[model samples]
Target: MMETGQVRDFAVGIEDSAIEDLRRRLAHARLPEKETVEDWDQGIPLAYVEELTAYWRDEYDMRRVGTVLSQWPNHLIAIDGLDIHFLHIRSPEADATPLVMTHGWPGSVLEFADVIGPLTDPVAHGGKAEDAFHLVLPSLPGYGFSGKPEAPGWSVLKIAMAWRALMAALGYERFCAQGGDWGSAVTIAIGALAGENIDGDPCRGIHSNMVWVTPPDEVMANPTEEEQAGLDRIAWYRTKDHGYSTQQSTRPQTLGYALADSPVGQMAWIVEKFHGWSDCGGHPENVYSRDRLLDNVMLYWLTNSAASSARLYWESFNSGEMPQIHMPMGGSIFPKDILTPSRRWAEKTFRNIVYWNRLEQGGHFAAMERAELFVEELRAWQRAATG
Candidate 1:
């Protein structure tokens, strides 16, 4: 293990050879036959994938990934024998609160691209200076530019502790944590562990867009309309949308061979989730641009991280029972997300709930699909947590 305080500046620099290789691969892609059905039930349509790949091979700017990520100050710090790549963007406001926002699977720091400007410089985005945050956006281990874990045991709790060490190394004695998807699990762990510390709590509070909560037996016996709808959503996910998780959890290495070797395979695998999980009527482009979607895909493709990233599921999928979070916590439940636990259900695990809301719009990729709403939710949670 290396000292966590040794931070080094890093940059996104994909070589020209890699770009040529990707284009060559896309040109000679072997696409499967179209789905028998016209809808996305079978996964991302073959026609759309062809169309997107054509654009990606020809028109999509190869330099966009570097350009977009270069807007912020990127860095790498050693923690637990891994090089953690993160974007440390400080607010113009000297008194801004420190916040560490995490991303989940099939998502990267790119998910927060639209909201970074607004959150870090509120005045520029027509918000109050007091609402600004000195943001820390990390690429999860085995994802993006971060180093893949060589051994097992880099579970959600371990990642949370690494994040805590990361914040402390950056001189944030106290900070707020925010996340969604797997990120929610990590943030919840941070909140749960804060109570066990003999020293002062490192995390001031935590917030999540995706909260997974099982209603108690009494509540499940007679769920409200919203609760019933949430239950239905859970059922839909487990039955219809959980094949990926099952594969990733049990045999990520086997699945990763295809995803890692073929760019088109990786693209279809991830883009399908964007379409199914987002508020997009039927197409992912309704919520995200072709370039933005490709930008995220490129992270996994360029890094060849399919097996390593999926291994997170293998490591932490059955994370046993949920740890009770006594710290001030907030929930922003998007209806179209995989799980939209109601306040009643969420309160069972998140004891000191400071904020909770169900938005009429948005989905799993809350920050990417609904950037403004996501930012507002964080600001609101901040106010509630502090006030």
Candidate 2:
């Protein structure tokens, strides 16, 4: 059992210093000249950055964003000297199952703002009573509002324990867990750790959006026809995708300085992701309104958390013990998800592969890109798994 301190306050108003810092960085920003690269083929363009910066300075309202989120019941709790921020929405119905959904990199609890009410209190939100769920959305350690880990061992395994402690701290004994990206990895770790409370049985089951695995170098290198296909797929992702991880894992301090300084740079970096990995194909704005993009970027900027969040890559790469998840599991696999893990690979790891989905549309931001599809898929899996 874990002890909880007083509920922490929501981030409603930005201090003058934060705004001053943003302005100072933008003013001192040593911008590079535009390259021959015409499109986002070389990441966010210099011209686009200037345009967005103008909008941010002239029009965006931090107070308005804060007020909109204030409609919910949000709180932060300190456990083991780390401040963890999360939102709790209880089901009006007495017997609804509680499902805790966690997000991955470059995101915050803001990702779920649009979908929480619909999931938590479906009846009031004009959905069937059967679809209601109690949602507990938390910021990952060193991400967004959560305090950065002071020690090295706060890897996925430790973070899993922290989450279990968090859920238990809030008085939830048995709950379903869902996540995509690192979120999915943590959910798998939760089920593996189980009730040991780290006392009795590990926790209940977990539902996931992505799984990580590295094949034995021998077989993976000299692959069969089928394995060759997976290898080729992975290589494609590496060339176009792994650059960000490589930079973060190796030289985070250098990159952090720039990302932490300029809000315009931060927004461009984060927004480009919504464009690249979402169903909008190229136009990210189609899936995430400017309000949504700003909300996520604001979580990073106001809290000055861009660097700390990037440290997860550093921690994981160093640890090198990517555990195979062998517990009862549910999966929500999206098509354009960089490198979608194979079912053959997943089945080897997850003990009970109860629910497996290959979604038709939607991409990296499954919940945000296709909320209706994401929710319905989750509901379908939960119903089948628990029953």
Candidate 3:
């Protein structure tokens, strides 16, 4: 059993001094010369980065970020020796299902802001009252406004445990869990312990965008074209794009110094992923507005969570413990996400996969990138979970 401690209201308001310091750092940032290649093979172009930093320093309004965060009812609850920050929105429908939506690294509760209205007030968003959900959006430990763990061992399993405590504390006897990236790992851990709740189950079902499943030996031996493509993509990522992961997983503290000191350094570090991982046609601007993208980055900057956030990778990425999930699982595969396994491969691990769909659009940040489709996917899973 998990116990929750005193909860306090949480509001977003960064100090003006900190905001001015960020601008000062951006204005005085030192830069390397242009990349050898014209393309992004060598990372973000220097000219592009210069333009972004100029806009960030001169035009971006930090107060707007505060206003956006203020729209939700935010709180910080003491759980397991840490303050877990979350946004909780109850639906008008009396019987709306409770849903815990978790955000991944480099993401905050901001990712799900657009979907909250649609999920919690479905009738207003062209859906039936029955489609409503009481949404709980938690900022993962060491990410966003949540209190960072001072010690090691706040791995995925522990995060799931904290989430269970949170839901229990909120009086949700039964609920659904949804996430992507690191959020998926935590949700999967919750499913592994889905059997231990007041209603005899913590998670009624789980839904994810980034599905991590170990394919069976036979399936891997002779994979389908899709499965092979997925494998190739993973391999390519390990080879070409995993440098950041390697550093975060192994030496976060070393990398954190640079990220913490330089606003432009942090911006470039995060924006590069927004460019590379998203389904945007060769540029991030195609999907996200400059303001929206900068708001997400500010979550990292204002909190100085670069080190704490990366510590999650250091804790869990090398643990080598694969949790067994027994509850109903649902998933959506975006064509341009970093990893997209075939249904056959995913089914080997998530046995009761009640819903699985390959989306024609969207990418890694599905909820932020395609809020309508993301809401629809969760609604679809909720319908299946109820049945």
Candidate 4:
């Protein structure tokens, strides 16, 4: 029996046996022969996967996820019949603004680990008390420690509404939203549905690292240098890197069997994204350590959430029409993201553009790869939105 809407304390507690089982699976992982190509064009090279698997099995600290996340107060609250897990960290500053940040696929709550302190306790992290935020970091349903959706229809919009319920249950009347990757899609949905009141609660604004918008034919006909670069990136992704998305969106269950059964399979599936999407300079290790990467992979491997998480793609990948958002919205466009929409293109959907900037460095995993910049962008957006 579960109590709906009750905010109960939750701690990550993976059994010792689960840890042993993961190592055993890694030990017996059956790998294929190395790729013929020297580069990642054929997919993540066999050698790199072998190297990562060895480190994961022999050297990586299995308890790192618990250790890193234990600093925050974790909680679980039932939202729309599913138990949602989140870290609700209040700032020491009395006037801190309430902000809900979401993480996307291939990313977990761990993505914000480095920036949590800076965002919640700005004074301690070389910022003013006014910049502090009461942060709510939720693990998307079916990912990490959150309960999986037993039925379909848990689309981005549904998740957005559930987040509203989650925040209202926490006593927040109004809050801002931020996200990247699929988190960006969720944040966009939140902004679209902001008018709906959860006991007078509303999402006041949104900031996203990944902005998705369709440019007008006129703009595409004669794109500026930066716009053209963004277009080229999109084209490249569609041609070279969209297979995983196609598989997940259309046939996640089939892909999930392998990912759920093999730890190395799960690791490689995600690590390739970290490599391709981040500003890693051709190697994922350029931006993230092996342990950090494993921390995210462990979330999926331990929970056996490969198929469940991928179902989100099937549910919302072609989310038909983009809703018009008139509320204050901000975007931080990173150079190396899969989709880099310029301000002109984004203005098509986001009517009230409060703040927009093109970052010099970073990629899809902004918070994880560039913590300082990600935090600063949020703070800057907060000032612009509320100022």
Cα-lDDT of candidate 1: 0.91
Candidate 4 has a TM-score of: 0.97
Please give each candidate's TM-score. 0.98, 0.89, 0.97, 0.97
* Local accuracy of candidate 4 as per-residue lDDT tens digits, 1-387: 123588999987888999999989999999999999999999999999999999999999988888888889999998878989999999999789999999999999999999999999999999999999999999999998999999998999899888878888988888999999889999988888855342343777899999977776856999988899999999999999999999999999999999999999999999999999999999999999989999999888989999999999999988798978887899999999988988888988888899999999999999999999999999999999977
Per-residue accuracy of model 3 over 1-387 as CA lDDT, tens digit each: 656897789888889898888878887899988899988888988988998888888898877778898998999998977999999999999999999999897777888878999999999999999999999999999998899999998999899999989998999988999999899999888887764341467578999999977667866799888888888878878888899999999999999999999888899899898888889999999999999989999999999999999999999986775655668889999877888888888876787889999889988899999999998998998898777
C-alpha lDDT score of every prediction, in listed order: 0.91, 0.74, 0.88, 0.91
TM-score of 3: 0.97
| All-Cα superposition RMSD per candidate | 1.4, 3.1, 1.5, 2.2
Q: Lowest summed lDDT over 10 consecutive residues: which window, candidate 4?
A: 194-203
lDDT value, residue 295 of candidate 2: 75
Q: List the lowest-lDDT window of 10 residues for candidate 1.
A: 194-203
Q: Give candidate 3 misplaced runs (Cα > 4 Å).
A: 195-199
- Candidate 1 colliding pairs: none
In model 4, what is the error at residue 118, expressed in angstroms? 0.4
What tens-digit string does per-residue lDDT give for candidate 2 at 1-387? 445576766655678787777767666666678967877788877887776676666677755556666777778988767888888888887677778888998777777777887787778766777777888888898887688887765677777777777777777787878888788778877877753232354355688766555645554656666456557767867887678889888777788898887777788778877776777867777677776787788888887887888888787776755555555678877776654665665666675777887777777778877887788778877787677
Q: How far off is residue 306 in model 3, in Å?
A: 0.4
